[model samples]
Target: MTAPSKQTVCIVDDDAQVRRFLAEVLASVGLVAEQHASGEDFMRRWQPGKAACVLLDIRMPRISGPEVHDWLRDREPGLPVIFLTGHADVTTAVRAMRLGAFDFIEKPFNVQQLIERVNQAVRLATDKSAAGSGNDGWQRALTRREREVLRGIIDGKRSKLIAAELGISERTVESHRASIMAKAGASNAAQLAAMAAGQPPLD
Candidate 1:
């Protein structure tokens, strides 16, 4: 019998035992884990195209997970990361979430849940990278007035300030913002900003 081809996963941690255990867990489910000793080690030999998802340890000997996350964000912003932490605090989890981590999982967690999130992250990455389709659908989805409102949103103007700038009511500005969020498939103002950053600012 032949073995199934492994889906590559990059595991970065300073502990040999932890790496081996993670590698073993991945291999159990027909996935392959490439172990790196530190954030520096992973960066030096980072291959962007191969790995499906990077499972990173938040606390390492030298470079930390958040640092590596920043590095990847600057270099390959599309890369997906799932942070593995021994210390799970509200602040840490919130910070990691803001930093675009797929999930912040504490140590001694259910192996199955971790794998499930990793699989979903891989799929999301695939979908987001595959086809962005047309910006026209997105543009047409916004009303003329909404586009005008969006310009201020992209320019970092507050809703009240935007209303004052455009000689409109704050309620009207909020309505346009809601419309913009729905049209762009973005959940929050920051997500709208990210989507706008991927395109030209509304003219």
Candidate 2:
């Protein structure tokens, strides 16, 4: 069978063995893998296209994964980033997620889970690229809380249910819903949900 895309899975880790293992795993799943010894090396080769996703080691000499992620945020915001960490901490995971990391996995990650997240990220990035420009504006306009509410709504949850899930009051959820609709320029809940799911708004 053919590979998913010609784009490569760029792995940035200081350890040679880890890089080798990850490359092998990705190959088994029909993904092209490219290795870099450090963040600087990866940055030197980074380009806008043909990168399915980045597997970045959290700790590296000189430029760290978080720093690389920050740079990518400005240079290539559409690129998906997945952090690899030897020491998994709540603080680090939360921070990485906040910065748009697809997912964070520890050193001894489950092979299945790793493949799943990587493939999922690749698919999501591909969809975003295929979607063109309409989704970007709505995505950028949403606040974090509004995003959470939109997700719940998209999952077919009621406003009260979404509020409970987010640990906020229903009124707050309603307010967020209103703000999200305004920002997305969606006429109704259905249209707002469509916009959140990366579909173009209806006329």
Q: For each candidate, how many residue pairs have backbone atoms clashing (under 3 Å)?
A: 0, 0
RMSD for all candidates, in order, please: 8.9, 8.2
Summarize candidate 2's per-residue lDDT along 1-203 as a digit string, tens digits.
22355358999999999999999999998889999999999989887776878999988999988988878766765576788987755357546654456677887879999999888767656555554466556555556787788788788799889988889988677656654553444545776667567543232
Model 1: C-alpha RMSD to truth?
Answer: 8.9
lDDT of each: 0.71, 0.74
Give the Å error, residue 107, model 1: 0.5
Cα misplacement distance, residue 180 of candidate 1 (Å): 15
Q: For residues 35-85, could you state the per-residue lDDT of candidate 1 as single tens digits?
A: 999999999989766776788888887788888987876665555677888
The lowest-lDDT stretch of 10 consecutive residues in candidate 2 is 178-187
Cα error, candidate 2, residue 9 (Å): 0.7
Off by over 4 Å in 2: 1-6, 88-90, 135-148, 151-203
Cα lDDT of model 1 overall? 0.71
